[model samples]
Target chain A: MIAEVLTIGDELLTGNTIDSNSAYIAQRLTERGYWVRRITTVGDDVGEIMSVIREILNRKPSVLVISGGLGPTHDDVTMLAVAKALGRDLVLCEDCLERIKQFYEELHRNGLIDDPTLNEARKKMAYLPEGATPLENTEGAAPGAYIEYEGVKIFVLPGMPREMKAMLEREVLPRIGERKFIQKKFLAEITDESKLAPILNEAIERFRVKIHSSPKGFGKFIGIIIFAEDEAKVKEVVEFMEGKGIRFMEGW
Target chain B: MIAEVLTIGDELLTGNTIDSNSAYIAQRLTERGYWVRRITTVGDDVGEIMSVIREILNRKPSVLVISGGLGPTHDDVTMLAVAKALGRDLVLCEDCLERIKQFYEELHRNGLIDDPTLNEARKKMAYLPEGATPLENTEGAAPGAYIEYEGVKIFVLPGMPREMKAMLEREVLPRIGERKFIQKKFLAEITDESKLAPILNEAIERFRVKIHSSPKGFGKFIGIIIFAEDEAKVKEVVEFMEGKGIRFMEGW
Candidate 1:
């Protein structure tokens, strides 16, 4: 399956924050056998976010993962943008509101909060797109929203790394099921990538595997990654390269 | 001025690499008073790269900074994609070629290279989009490229962080000129962001300054950023917030 990640925040666009959340999501998705095609980050502008969502939805990847802008502030517009793009109304999820209330009550008991009543900003976190299911947020007040649009599974999670990670692990991963990918890495003490480029290209074409070579500076070694769903094809390319007198190191 | 960043590499999409390049470029641009609107990352695919370029070009940001895929490997397709997107041919830049040759000659003299002769893959780095100027690379073999399309300034730099940084500092920064931005950050020990959201919204509307409040964990403190082009407006908002019993800390 193919997946794409869209992250939204003005802080991210202005270099105020580095998007480690997308990297974490991509890594998890890749581990689950999803080929992440693209990762796009936009600011908190609603128009830009909506246009990007429309574009990505046009691509119709099997899964679209969105993160960020799920806070209880003026700039938190991810849910609204998604609703506008999907042509859905923003509706309050009662379960999500109950959870937020309970969370604040516990915080108030622990002296973390002065009031347990759901304020306007806190109630904003309970609203999701119509017909969307609210994903439980174990770490934060803003519950994530999930919806299936035109056969594409769209998952919207918070931008905070801690909250997003907990929700992803608990809510998103289980539904993705299990799949394995064939990937191998070979390191060789080759000085020139230009010299090995032709052979690598030939192996890629012959075995139908994607081969990537990174030259580790001058006079060091070259790292090669052979990735494909066909394990046998990757092995064939590796054997071919080894037969060409390239000494493969123990690990990448 | 508005700016956007595009980072290209398959390793980035596969989660093998985190894109620090975009953040670096965005920070530099932001410091120069350019409001960075979006940052897009795509894998080493020609079609995807071309489509993203077309999309960003349609947005017509004042500046577009592109990094990565300027290497001597099969997956290095950024230059080719840019050329195709602009309907320009891939022409060998003589200046860039000379620099590549000199770079290899120095490597050979220092015993870092066995052959000083430019091979096919190395020569590929010398080819750039037609009518594009080459930016000298002080740290690597591949030279960067700069072009103007539809009144928008576009810069393509190397993917390697060291080389990209060197080229950016040396060649790119000077042409961008200097612009000052008024930005002040206030940290307050507040537990509830929801309670302060209305005040922040009013402050934003009153002074026309972009104010962002980041809740620093549970029951700790909130960091608020006040940004605007008008220094007087920022100061007025700061004073108003302080007058409203919000104890402002020393610094962000």
Candidate 2:
């Protein structure tokens, strides 16, 4: 399956943030046998986020995971953008509003926040797209949304690393699918990366496997990761490359 | 000026790498007074890289900095993809070829490699799109390309962080422009981010300054960054927000 990650935040665009969130999401999706086609990052602006989401939907990826801009702030307009992109209206999830209220109240009770009251800003977190199921956020106030629009599953997640990771594992992963591919990492003892290119190409062409090689350093070690349906296939490709004079050390 | 970054690498797509390169590029671009609108990451496939480059170009960004897939391996098709995207031809850069040969030969001379042969793989690094200037890579063999296409300045740099950073600083930064922004980072003493929304939005609207806010925690501190053309403009926004009862520390 093909997947795409869209991370929305002004911090990301201006480089105030390094966006380790997309990498985490991409790795999880890749482990689940999804070919993450692309990862796109835009600011927290609704128009830009909406335009990019529409473009991603047009490409018809099997799944789309959107992270960031789901908070109560004015710039956190991801939910509104997702609704606009899907041609859906934003509707209040009463259940979500109740949870958000409790979350704030609990924070207030613990002296973490000054107010336990729900104002317009806090109330904003309760709205989801018309057809989206509110994904529970056990770690944060913003409730994620899961929408299946025109055969593509789109998820809106929080931007905070701790919150996004919790929501993704608890709410997102269970919905995508099971992991199916076997990925083996190895360090190939090649004198240089260029010398390994031709043999690597021939191996990939011969075997029904996917291989990615990157230079580890100037000399004798290059990192190569092999992906296949089973261990046998990985071994076959490994043997073929080994026969071509590439020495391998498992798992660097 | 508006800018965008496209990072091409299978490792990035697979989440094997976190794409810290784009963040570094974006930060430098922002410091240079460019609004980095979007950052895109795609695999090392030629079609994928070319299509994304064409899309980014279509947006008419003032500058586009592309990193990754600029190596000697078979997957390093960035130059070829860039040529196709711009409807140009990949021509051999004679000076670049000499440098690449020397780079590899030096490694061999240092006993870093078994041989320093200019095979098709190694020679691939010396090609640049027609009419593009070859950017010197002081950290690696592959020479980057700087192309001025249809009013957009496009830079293709290496995937390695050390190489990309060196080329970006030594070659890319000098060509883009001088740094021209004043960014002030502050920790706003707010009860919650939700409460800071309307005031933050109003400050941005009143002053010609950009404001980005993210929650530091569930507590009374939220990180806010202000971007303005001058220190006076930033101070005006800061005072306006302070008038709204949001106490701010000088810096975080």
Candidate 3:
């Protein structure tokens, strides 16, 4: 199975805010055995959000995870686009309202703040797509949104790393079960990548493979990942390289 | 201008590899005033990669930044999809090859490793699409690929955060210069969001404005952002809200 992650924020595009959400989500998704093919980051523009979401849906990914723009701020329009894409009405979730009320009441009881600001926050969290399941956020105020339509699961979480991480671990991962996977890698310590051009070509031709080059310290060491679904075939391909005197340093 | 970010790797999806590269790229793009509109994460499947790329293209982002899958690995086919997307033939960049050789020699001189491994690593970085510009990775073995076709700029960077950051800062940012942008945020305290919801809706409808619900404490604190081409207009929109009793927060 495959998944696509979409992070929403204008701050992300301007380089003002580094999108830690995508990295966290990507790592979690990968560990769950879903093939995370592509990650997209968009600003809080409705047209852009709608366009990207529509495009991802066309690819028919098993799942789509989105972050940011669920806030009740002026630029926070992620919910709107999500509702538009999923063909759902953006209605207030009463359950979310009660959760907010109770939370503020507790905080007020503790003298966190006199005003408590509970209803204001609750009103923001109350808005959700019709029929979307609200992912409880025990750590933060804003709850994440989970919608399953047409057998494709779409999870929406806050852009804040802490909140996103909590929801992903507590809610997202459980929905995606464990699956099998294979890993492979190729390593070389040579200098001129051009000299190995023919070799790379040959490997691709013979094993139907593609290799990545990770050169470190002015080309002192290079690591390449050779991945596949078939572990045995990958081993066979590595053996062929070993025949040509290429030794595996790690990952196969 | 709008830019779309693409991160490729099964590791990202299966929850093994954290895609920090996307954040780095998104932050950089955002700083340049280019809306990092959509970030799509996909695995190492050729068909899926192609489909997602096509989908991003359909969104008509001015630039596309891609990271990962540029290895000598069996699953690293990002270049192939890119080549196919551009209808170009895959070829080797000779300068990149020479750089790889020099990189290896330095590595060997520092006693990092022997020559045989260097040979394989260099080979891994040699493949390129015809007419592509090779962006040397000083931090890693894989030389990044930068291709400009039509009016869209497409960059292929190593998945490693270090390599991606190095190339993006040294090479990509300079290419995208001086774009205009405005960042605005609005805060409302001592008021219920539900009371202001109808007002916000009316304000948006009356003035053709956009606002998001950024509830910080689930209902305790709230923030709204309004992004526009005109900084003055963004402020005007915020003022319009304040006129309606929505106070100001930070980052306006």
Candidate 4:
């Protein structure tokens, strides 16, 4: 299955913040047997986000995970953009608003905040793209959204690492798939680069797997990763190479 | 003044790598006064890379900085993709081949590799799109390419962070014009969100500046960043906000 990742935030485009969110999301999606074909980062821009979403939809990825811009700030326009892209509207979730109110009230009780009232800004977090199922936020006030549009699963998550991770584990992964994205790594002991080159080419030709090899200082060992549909396929490719005189070390 | 970043690597798409190169490039581009609008990542597949490059060129950004997939591997097809996207042929860069030969020879001398022969894999790094100038790679064997096609300054650099940084500083930055990208951050003392929201919105309205404000908790201070074409514009927005009773703290 093919997937795409979209990260939204001006901080990312400004280079003030490195987008570690997409990496984490991509890793999770890859583990779920989704080939993350394209990953895009854009600012907190409605038009840009909407147009990118449209483009991704046109490409027909099975799933699209969008991170960031789901905050209470004025620039947090991902939900609005998502609505517009899908030709929907923004609708307030009463359950989400209630949870947000209680979240702040609990914080107020713990002396973390001076006020417990939910202003318009905080209330904005409760508004999601119309028809999106509200995914509970265990770590923060902003709840994520899971919407399926035109057979494509679209997920909207927070930008904060802690919150995004919690939501992905609790709400996102269970919905993607059970197929495993299996890849096995090995260190091949090879003194001659020429001997291994042909073997590597033959392995690629024979097996329906993607092999990545990087020379580890070019001395006696090179690191190789075999990715396939299942663990057995990875092991099969490894054994085929080993049979051709490519010895695998105990560790990489 | 607009720039886009395209990073090519299977490692990046598979989440084996975090794509720090784009952030570093974007930061440098931002320092050179280019507003990095979007950052995209794709695998080493030539067709995928070529399609994305064409899409980026169609967007007509003033600059497009592409990093990665310049190494000597089966998957390193960025140079080929770039050539195809620009409707040019891959011409052998003789000087680049000489440098690659010498680099491997030096490695062989240093006992890093068993052979220094210019094999097909190593020699493949010497090819470039027709009419493109080879950008010297001081840290590695592969030489980067800088080509201006249809008014867009396209730079293709190595994926290795060290090599990419060296080429960017020594070669890429000199060719791009000198324009400062300045943003000033301040910690504004404000206890209420309602108090600073108007000031921030007003500041955005008054100056041609991009303002970002994040609450540092429900506490007495919020972080603000004013971004503009020049330093004076940023300072002007800051002063206008300060005049509206927003007290600035010394540090973040």
Scored by lDDT, the top model is 2
Worst window of 10 by summed lDDT in candidate 2 chain A: A212-221
- What tens-digit string does per-residue lDDT give for candidate 3 at A173-195? 88777653355655665545444
Model 4: clashing residue pairs? Answer: none
Query: Best candidate, DockQ-wise?
Result: 2
Tell me the lDDT of candidate 2: 0.88
Q: Give the per-residue lDDT of model 2 (tens digit) for A174-215.
A: 998876667899999865566787887788788856678876
Comparing candidate 2 with candidate 4, which one achieves the higher DockQ?
Answer: 2
* Collision pairs in model 1: none
Question: Model 4 TM-score?
Answer: 0.93
Q: Give per-residue lDDT, candidate 1, residue A129.
A: 99
Q: Score the docking of each candidate (DockQ).
A: 0.58, 0.64, 0.33, 0.56
Model 4, span B110-150: residue lDDT tens: 98777888888788899999999999999998999999999
lDDT, candidate 4, at A104: 91
Clashes of 4: 0
DockQ of 1: 0.58
lDDT per model, in order?
0.84, 0.88, 0.71, 0.86
Reference-based lDDT, residue B145, model 3: 82
lDDT of 3 at B20: 63
What is the per-candidate TM-score for chain B? Answer: 0.88, 0.91, 0.80, 0.90
Kindly report the interface RMSD of candidate 4, rounded to 1 decimal.
Answer: 2.6
Q: Write the per-residue lDDT of candidate 2 for residues B1-252, one digit (tens) a residue.
A: 899999998898888889899999998898888899999999888898888999998999999999998887667889999999999999999999999999999999998787788877788889999999999999899999999988999999998999999999898888877757778999998655666878887987888677778766664678889988889988889888888899999776
Candidate 2 residue-wise lDDT at B4:
97
